[model samples]
Target: MAPFLKEFFPDVYKKQSEIKDSSNQYCKFNSATLTMFTSSLYLAALLASCVASYITKAWGRKISMLTGGITFCVGALLNGAALSVWMLIVGVDL
Candidate 1:
């Protein structure tokens, strides 16, 4: 969390690192952004899962799995190459 914050939101990282509170370390900056960032991935997974069986049935299990793997790889690549926080968030939500 610290490293990610320092990489993207440097100012937030600097201010957060100055805090004496250890228990609330990861969330001292912005709860809303943190919530959205963390929750979006789970929400995306939930949405995908809701349609996974239908997709598998339509495309067959092998093709469905392959497509999912490719999509995961692409999202990972996007995240690895992300230039901004929004890009990172989008990659995560993919």
Candidate 2:
């Protein structure tokens, strides 16, 4: 399996362990439902990301990057300080 996968997609195979670690951590944080909900939100965010990319195209890369960084920091703080699982979900959306 290793030989077959590496022959086809070495970079993807190399990242398998990290993917597993992320999956394990995701499961530990919440139940399966929450994980699925979060994944759906992530997909939604990816679609939103395309809009963001277009909106920021004329705004300058540095400014857009900083805005995204700040938004992520705010989200992390809310998630870390959440009082309930629902709040955590809302925070993750931020």
Candidate 3:
């Protein structure tokens, strides 16, 4: 079971190096900085997910879903408008 899980999620183990390469391709940064930036962005998204989940509970499932849909749209627009890493970060924050 353990081996099967590990094989199935090999990307999970290799994701950091892959991401570091991708980040370097997209932006001028060292691996360490890239890791921090990616981690920060992930943290932001996780927080957003938590907030959305809570709001969904308070506002009803439909309303929460609608809000999440809008957030997804905004995120796509941000990606399209991204000129730099900072823009990407700001877009995700939005």
Candidate 4:
């Protein structure tokens, strides 16, 4: 996904390249920024799962499912309307 984003989004790819080149820690590796950014989704999902489990236990399954569905739709809208990589990241994180 990181590689695909870099290939398809020129603005994001360029910004990531600049950031990577400027950061000493990531300067040694190409696509390091994108790799980290993409990998964060897994972490976000893991954390969201824990929260969702609690929500389900407290609110009931139906409510929990509806909330999740609504959240997903909102996140999709945010991602679709993103104007920059940061916005896209925020949307995906949501």
| Candidate No. with top TM-score | 1
Put down candidate 1 lDDT per residue, 1-94, tens digits, no spaces. Answer: 8888878878777877688777865556764666677788898798779777889999899988998898888889999999887787888766
Candidate 3, clashing residue pairs? none
What is the per-residue lDDT of model 3 for residues 1-94, given as tens digits with 9 covering 90 to 100?
3443244334444554355555355433334544654676788788888898899889998998888889879987986777665666667676
Candidate 2 error regions (>4 Å): 1-32
lDDT of 2 by residue, 8-38 (tens): 3455456563464563543333335445545
In model 3, how large is the Cα lDDT of residue 61?
Answer: 89
Give the number of the best model, judged by lDDT: 1
Using alpha carbons, what is the TM-score of model 1? Answer: 0.78
**What is the Cα-based lDDT of residue 39 in candidate 2?**
82
- Weakest lDDT window of 10 consecutive positions for candidate 2: 25-34
Report residue 45 deviation for candidate 3 (angstroms): 2.7
For all predictions, the C-alpha RMSD in Å is 2.3, 12.5, 11.3, 6.3
Q: Could you tell which candidate, 1 or 2, scores higher by lDDT?
A: 1
Candidate 4 residues 1-94, lDDT tens each? 5665665465555666656355366444455556666776887798789989999999999999999889888889987887666766777777
Q: After superposition, how far is residue 45 of candidate 2 from its true place, in Å?
A: 3.2
- lDDT over C-alpha atoms for residue 4 of model 3: 30
lDDT of each: 0.80, 0.63, 0.65, 0.73
Cα TM-score of candidate 3: 0.59
